[model samples]
Target: MQVNNDRLTLAVAKAPQIYLAGVIDADAPQRFESMMRSGKIANGSDIYLNASGADLHAGIALGRLFRQGSMVTHLGTQRRQRGAPAKPALCTDACVYAYLGGLYRWAPTGADRIGFPAQMAVDPKASADPDDTSAYLKEMDIDQSALAPLLTAAHADPAWLPADQLIAARIANNGRLPLTATYQVQNGEPYLTLAEVKRGGQHRMSLECRRDGVLFTAYNAVGAEHAKQIVAHGARSFVEVNHAESYPPQQDYATVQDDAVVIARTYPGAQLGSLISATTLGAWVRDRNSMLRYGFEFELGGLDHILRKYYQACWEYAPWQVAKKS
Candidate 1:
């Protein structure tokens, strides 16, 4: 076993396989290309074993290739510190995306599964846009419905999707077929870009999270009608929280680039001259998932083009609560 701290590396065995573990860093693209050229991974001959679960700021383009490198088997702890106990296999952040590279991918249930390993941890700070994953699922020829369950399962800890679910989702198209002699993992769908109108300088947003809950305020000079328009547009576009009546969102402008989150909106109300949105990210709102509140604001009429100023408070998450690690 070879230990290469934190970065992606291959554990060469006495066979024709390369075992990979650790974070896929920014340099992973070049490294992966080198390996593919050097015959470390091949279409029909080599199988890649992955245990990495973090991205370490890796780019999405690099992640695409790393995922397509080979058919991957989620191995738990084949290589570890001396005399250490076996660990649960985890695939978080971009590592999970890379796992999609397989002509055939297999994940063992860590403790409860028969035939395959029992449980694999898949928790990570993930994208908020379901479409981000839905697009990829389309390219992989997998059902888009699989994404919701995967995200929900990976909500707090490592996860294992039932093989039955994968088959039904068509992610396991060939039914646990590990070696596909002539298969090729295709490129995933490109992220979408939509029309955007920035807030210009008319609106100002602020956030403060307390023990009771999080408070968000947006002061807009766009008037009451403007606030209503914002809410109406977001209701049709942004991913609604629970019901449109209870938790209203105003973010529907753009998809975040990475783990970057959008910090906007709340229970926005029109005041004397400004529009304010407030909500509690706690049980006070009777919502357990209310710990983090976010959304976006689109200023009306030429906010971006007329004034030639564009500023939208998108991609906002409480930094103190998150630790991006392996």
Candidate 2:
């Protein structure tokens, strides 16, 4: 696996007194109360992971590569353009708001669920022996004729292919055999054709053997490091509480680049604008898995209020020092 761990760091000026209160355990409460009474708390610099931008970029790149030449009827645009094209009219503010607002409304609740815009099970009636094949084709709407060659190449040598590649090939072939007539010969036999076997007992032996062979090769091709990288990259974004600023500038955050994850830091001065900015920053770093892990530093006046209220209140604090580990 290739791991690129470069990272970028951004520094925001934070309120000094609030930052000081965070470091002194014994004096924290008194200092916090004093600041609150004096109304001296002001806007403080906050650190953000900027992972959303990364995710959006990744989505865009992947879309560009995979969805090229595709047309979106509603958008009145093609995924790619050969030359300058007329700009489509903007969607109405109400329509745009409704569409975007719905996405946000459902995002948190739907995070745990796996969603596919198009998913379909194998049509048992369409297959002669569905049990023997058990292959489910997705994206059946895609023109199979355009995808046949890729599938044929992939099926010719499954050993070198990844599961995603295999799935893509299967989808491209419209759920049929992914081979051409040219490469069907193996040991003077037609390897491309499905062979007839006795039903039940004797058939079970051949099926078991074939399954074992597949499992063996699949396991052989998958490396432990590669699997680890995949899991790291796929980890869901987490909100880190209390351990804010523990991250070592860009270096510590960069450690997760291979994993495609990021940590967003929240502090006493956090507001809606800062939060939104941090979230957007975390989302922008794309080399990693396109997820942001948010970190919130706990202190007085930083919690309990709505996002907009919190932002308004936090802007009154003085610049403070961010604690660092010696």
Candidate 3:
């Protein structure tokens, strides 16, 4: 266990788990890079962020390093006594920006804290540039709203973000991006696809509206192996909506297509209404012995509006128009 108690201290008492502490000044980045060059810390290491504040530019630089290394950041400090119980740690000012760099970020828990301070007040010689920080946050897929508290904070203190807000805006995402639904056209036919990327892999599903009904297809990259196993032996597949069984299980319903495992089915057009009104959707594969072989769920964010557009493009019909006609 090595410890450095300088302006910024970086230690790797536990392999692949680097512990960081102290204040971050302009030289923080260079010191961090030196720690990196020591080969003690590996890529994708867990970075325990125990620092309080940082120089604006210096924090951004450290953030870029965190992203490049695909690190995970948590708010906590190292224990002087080995195996000691967890203690509270605060990451404030530009340190908040550094925390956002983690590929997989854990929200501040219990007494652990993260906040944004008035940059100039925190460091009189700080080269604080809101534009640069804004761009960096955008690149991290953080909502612009996360920046508002920083720019508008009281000069005497730091603005702390609640854990819920951090998770909602994805500032403390557990290695996942927000799911999105998009309207796309192929061969003059419009369809809707909902997709998301996470540490596990990508999950996508498409809905095609037809005169008879709607065709639903789930493409699961993570389930590719399970799909192949099904083709070789056999298994039952089903779709789930809001944690309830939405489709009947059938043998050999999964098929491998290129890199993903796909399951396609058709349902009554009114089913589209149920889906549009639902909050979550998922697909599953079950073994003959009744075990859950594999599955994944998707949050139906912004899908209702896109599905409405798909209905109009498919059959020149919108639910509101039909409601008005009646």
Candidate 4:
């Protein structure tokens, strides 16, 4: 509710933006179902698929293509959602985040190399029927060399190396460059982007970068649009809270660090509620005290109980609506 560009500095103060896309073979659906039932794919795990084997190879090929590129962080396989038994449904969500973060790219063309050893197939009924067969296979052997074209196609023309590799190379090339970029957005508001740079006694690059609003604005816009879409699609969530005083503090408040803002929201039932400081809610409250004040709604028990439970709840139901003048 209180949009504090200042708090964007906290490590966990800001919401993470993600963009995802995937290519899965026909059998991938069945394979994913099997994996879900067998516990091979759990909740919150990052998964990728290629309709054609090409993209699958490209994903794995990243390891070799960016051998010197260490900036790219690889997330491991996460567990599938509790109710969903389909692989595509789960992997799609994961890929969106990876793609938005610029950590992932899928091939425009797919190679239906279903027989590839790296492929994994799920057979939900495999146990019941001994002959039940699934074409899915998990790719274990990643041929980095085979990935060159797929990577190139998935990315913009004159394709850069994989994101992880590119970030690594950028870091290696410029010792002064920051390792990560921070992003933030308020509903119906302009987005903000910030980077952590090394500040020198006489030559502060960070200051220079901030002063160049044009560059920062452009970068922020890119990240902003990407974050917006991700949030709209239910791929990523955001929260606003009071800044914790100590490391891993028990209090539920958002905080800022050098160049990031982190907010946390926990869902009690179906509705997600955020614990925010009064200071943070000042901005939204300044305008109106109505329920529609915040950019989004806190759907705890739906509209029926919104008013009744809102004031009684300890955490603010919708702080974004309470606006305060800077």
The predictions' CA RMSDs to the true structure, in order, are 21.3, 31.1, 6.5, 21.9
lDDT (10s digit) by residue, model 4, range 9-59: 224423221112245333433544454456543332222332222344233
lDDT of each: 0.37, 0.23, 0.70, 0.26
Per-residue lDDT value at 318 in model 4: 33
* Clash count, predicted structure 2: 38
- lDDT of model 1, residue 284: 12
Q: What TM-scores do the predictions have?
A: 0.36, 0.16, 0.72, 0.18
Residue-by-residue lDDT tens digits, candidate 3, 83-160: 887788889876777887888898888898887655422222323564376667777766666545544653345767
Judged by lDDT, which candidate is best? 3
Q: Please give the distance, in angstroms, between residue 63's alpha carbon in candidate 3 and its true position after superposition.
A: 1.5
Q: Rank the candidates by TM-score, best first.
A: 3, 1, 4, 2
Better of 1 and 3 by lDDT: 3
Candidate 3 wrongly placed segments (more than 4 Å):
1-15, 34-43, 77-86, 118-132, 146-156, 159-162, 210-212, 223-235, 248-252, 255-261, 287-293, 303-305, 317-326
**Clash count of each predicted structure:** 20, 38, 0, 63
**Model 1, clash count?**
20
Which residue window of length 10 is worst by lDDT in model 3?
317-326
Q: Model 2 off-target regions past 4 Å?
A: 1-262, 266-280, 284-307, 313-326
